[model samples]
Target: MIDKTTQPALQRLRLNLRQLEVFLATARGGSTRAAADRVARSQSAASTALAELEAALGCELFDRIGRRLQLNENGRALLPRAQAIVDQAFEAQDLFLGEHAATLRVGASFTIGEYLLPGLVSRWTQLHPRSLIQLRIGNTSEVLDAVAAMDVDIGFVEGSQTHPDLVMQSWGHDEIVVIAAPGHALAQQCATPQQLSQATWVVREHGSGTRQVTDEWLLGHLEQVRIGFELGSNEAIKRVVAASDGLGCLSRHAVEQSIADGHLIELATHLPKARRKLAIVLHREKKLGRGASDFLAHCRAAAAF
Candidate 1:
């Protein structure tokens, strides 16, 4: 592998926005025809661009298999770096060509995005009207992955991430509270660990942050507790719990409105409160825009656990 210290200067020799765009388009589209469709270029133009890109970089980025061009090992290796460069290039555009260097691209997971971010974004925009803030919302794991890949400027998530390329910041705290329909039998009763273990639970689908924490809580106990159902989205889970006898785990914040509306109730008693950390994460190496910095500061100051 080339030394990391020298790759930036070496990169300048081969990197051009158009070539990178072509390469990225090919990677995303998975074929020349598809890339052409996306970029509105002819198939031959896409092919030539890929060739020129490979030649300029002194490496073949893709291997042709049948009519398809599949990413080769080298291309797979360069994808992240190439993508980072592309992201930086787009971010830098706010500096000279179009808007001032004042736009923020913020990514967030569903819980925070829906329940926590509107006021924060509004406050930031009110303070800095010239700064454009774009929001991207996804599942928790996806949001962290985007930050690690530099596809987003910064991310807010409901759980911790351990990627070495990320610097995690504790924005606040939360809890994965067990919630059921407001008038359910267990709503007013005290639930011991043993009693709680006996109940069937409706759970979130895999990859959900709430499910992860719930599983962790059940690790040393309740190996026999049954998962009654699995579904995605807080709304779906809430609907099932509201109409059925099942219970599920949810971020306390995500269900506050429903809880207030008497649609859900906490599982009984003073059992251990399974606390979760709400975090803001960023690529360890990426520079932040002034807008991103301002928004992050607002979150730190105003967003409560």
Candidate 2:
């Protein structure tokens, strides 16, 4: 027999799945209008779906401000759960869509992607030839943004984690060394934070994990670490330090090649070792698919070996 009380949810509008999809779309797109475009529906339809979703879920998922939808704390809290639902739903879709063509999107901050990730991703491709791997590289801050937007499967970043949407687990560690061209006077002197600060330094652009930690660590002596230039790549920074008298901060891994060949020398700072955590970050709600799971495992194995 048909039940009358459940008709609105069951018969009139169907289950809340589509509305949930609309809610997620709007959250990710930043607007109901944009969400409509993603799902090929009208703006009114998307807005209605969101309204109904909020009503049925008994919580306001988004706060409408003028023409835009901004997620409130409640909405922000639901984002991970909604994203996890979508990720699981997408994985289920993969079973029907043919798993081979599904792409695993990954985000890695510059240092890890440029210096460490390619080898691991390359090895993963060989092991799972049918899977596709896509990498998005940026500073840790930017990478975190991409992860929040659901643009990537995972992120490997340097520095401590800040975002509430993401879960950060230590994947490895990187040792930072202060370096200069072989003959720079700082190399010969006892590298106190004060002496290090006095010289002009070329550093990674702001929001880089490297820049963030170095900035915090050098707080009492900012005057000493004067800005010479803010370059984008670790390699470029190393090159600048190599060709000029400017000093730089670098990962021990990034400069090992140069240090062995005697181009850049690590300064012995009065401060103890400068170590930054390399963490694997992903949305707390995002379920790892088979390919992503395989990749995360490979990352741990590679770090160990």
Please name the candidate that would achieve the greatest TM-score relative to the true structure: 1
lDDT of 2 at 16: 60
What TM-score, over all chains together, does every model reach?
0.81, 0.79
Instruction: Report the poorest 10 consecutive residues by lDDT, candidate 2.
Output: 8-17
Model 1, range 77-171, lDDT digits (tens) per residue?
A: 77666766766776677567544345577888878887889888887767766667789988888888778755678999876546777888888
The collision pairs in model 1 are: none
Q: Where does model 2 exceed 4 Å of error? A: 1-19, 36-60, 96-101, 182-195, 216-223, 258-271
lDDT tens readout by residue for model 2, 46-137: 98998888887678877888888888988877777776677677677778765544688899998898889998888888877777888999
Candidate 1 lDDT score relative to the true structure: 0.78
lDDT of each: 0.78, 0.83
